[model samples]
Target chain A: EAGVAQSPRYKIIEKRQSVAFWCNPISGHATLYWYQQILGQGPKLLIQFQNNGVVDDSQLPKDRFSAERLKGVDSTLKIQPAKLEDSAVYLCASSPAQSLHFGNGTRLTVT
Target chain B: AQSVAQPEDQVNVAEGNPLTVKCTYSVSGNPYLFWYVQYPNRGLQFLLKYITGDNLVKGSYGFEAEFNKSQTSFHLKKPSALVSDSALYFCAVRDGVNQGGKLIFGQGTELSVKP
Candidate 1:
């Protein structure tokens, strides 16, 4: 079976610019997640969605980051006015059960 | 709040030797523990999880982890290490009672198996 899919394997943007990342989860998966992994650090959960509704997004920076899963199949995460501290890899994952399957991730470099 | 900690920044072991990556956690009640592996520039892949079952849980790629509730620890282990096994490992935990539970991840442990 195919795993979670993400678009734009890599991205580069200047500080204060805006960037967006897309994710397409596994077929029939009920839960989707977005995480941010800074270099040399473990991934931090940014947001989670169960179907079309958000489950948790308490850790997300509401002032600069936002995400949505409209159809419960695909999702998008956006960062406006990006900061240098935002340079990290954005990962998308899905879970049919309790175990999560991840994508290759989008590496964002903010200069 | 639930949180996880990977005490080691990196671990180096000779191929064919036993390997272990240490992890500890803090949670209010019973914890749902997990281990994940990530290759360079890639996302995390589920390795194993301890969810109200046996203390020792085996998972993909010949990996296993022991969950010690008394100590609040879940350390990843393997009998024989391989060069290919070198990668970053993370430990995570969630509050069992929280329906919409969110995983709290450790900083990560980098494993290097030297051939």
Candidate 2:
């Protein structure tokens, strides 16, 4: 089975720039998630979607970060006017049952 | 609030010796614990999970964990360690009730197996 797919394996941008990350969850998976992993830290949940509906995004910084799941299939997470602290890896995962399968992730380096 | 803790930042052992990585968690409802391993520059890979069955659960790559409800701990263990077993291991707990079964992860523990 194909694992969750994410694009732009690496991205480098200056502070105050806008950047977006894309995720394509595994087929037939209803639960999709976005997480941010800083160096030396475990991944932290940014948002979760169940069948195209947002289930939880309380940790998402709505002021600068936004995400959307289209047709319950793929998702996109965006950071506008990114900050220096936004340098980290963005991981996308999908769950068909209890546990989640993750993609390689996109590493964002904010200068 | 549900949370998991990996008290150790790193664990080191020689190959052919037994290895243990400690984890503890606190949550309401079923503990629904899990262990995942992540290699550098790669995503997390599921190693095992503890839902409701036996206190001792076996998983991939010759890994196993004993779930102790009395102590609220789930520790990953391997009878014989291999150099290939080195990676960053994360302990997570599934929130059985709220936030759509969110998985909360600990800071992660790095394991180094020297041959």
Candidate 3:
């Protein structure tokens, strides 16, 4: 079986610029998640989706960040007016049950 | 709130020697623990998880973790280290009450296995 897929393995943008990352999870996987992994830190959950509805997004910066899993398949995460601090790798993962399977991730460099 | 701690920033070991990465967690109720490994520029890959049963949980890549409830610890271990095993390891935990399946992760520990 194929693993989770993501696009634009690497991205570079300037501060205040808008950027978006995409993810396509494993077929039939019910749970999808987006995480931010800053250097020297573990991945932090930014948002989670169960089917097309959001399960949790408490840590997401509503003012700057947004994500959607349309039709309960592929998903997208956007960070508008990006900040230098947002220069971290964005990871997309999915779970069939308890254990998670992650993609290669998109390395975003915001100037 | 649930939290996890990996006290060691890095650990160094020689080939054929044993290796360990320490982790501890705090939660209100029963906890579900997990271990993951990440190569440079790659996303985390699941190693093993402790839902219940025996304290020793073996995972992929010939790695294992021992869960000690009383100590609130789940330490990853490998009997013989390999240079190829050098990578970043993370420990995570999920609380029973929330059931949101949200995981709290540790800072991460870099394991360096020398040849």
Model 2 Cα lDDT, one tens digit per residue, A1-111? 888899999999999999999999989999999999999999999999999999999999999999999789989999998999999999999998789899999999999
State the lDDT at B34 in candidate 1.
Answer: 91
| Docking outcome class, model 3 | medium
Docking quality tier of candidate 1? Answer: medium
The whole-model lDDT of each prediction reads 0.92, 0.94, 0.94
Give the per-residue lDDT of model 3 (tens digit) for B53-79. Answer: 999999999999999999999999999
- On a 0 to 1 TM-score scale, where does candidate 1 land against the true structure? 0.97
After superposition, which runs of candidate 1 have C-alpha atoms over 4 Å from their true positions?
Answer: none
Candidate 2, residue A57: Cα displacement in angstroms equals 0.4
**lDDT by residue (tens digit), candidate 1, B18-54:** 9999999999988888999998878888999998879
Instruction: Place model 2 in a CAPRI quality band.
Output: medium
TM-score of 2: 0.98
Q: Given candidate 1, what's the lDDT at residue B39?
A: 89
Alpha-carbon error at B26 in model 1, in Å? 1.0
Q: After superposition, how far is residue B97 of candidate 1 from its true place, in Å?
A: 1.0
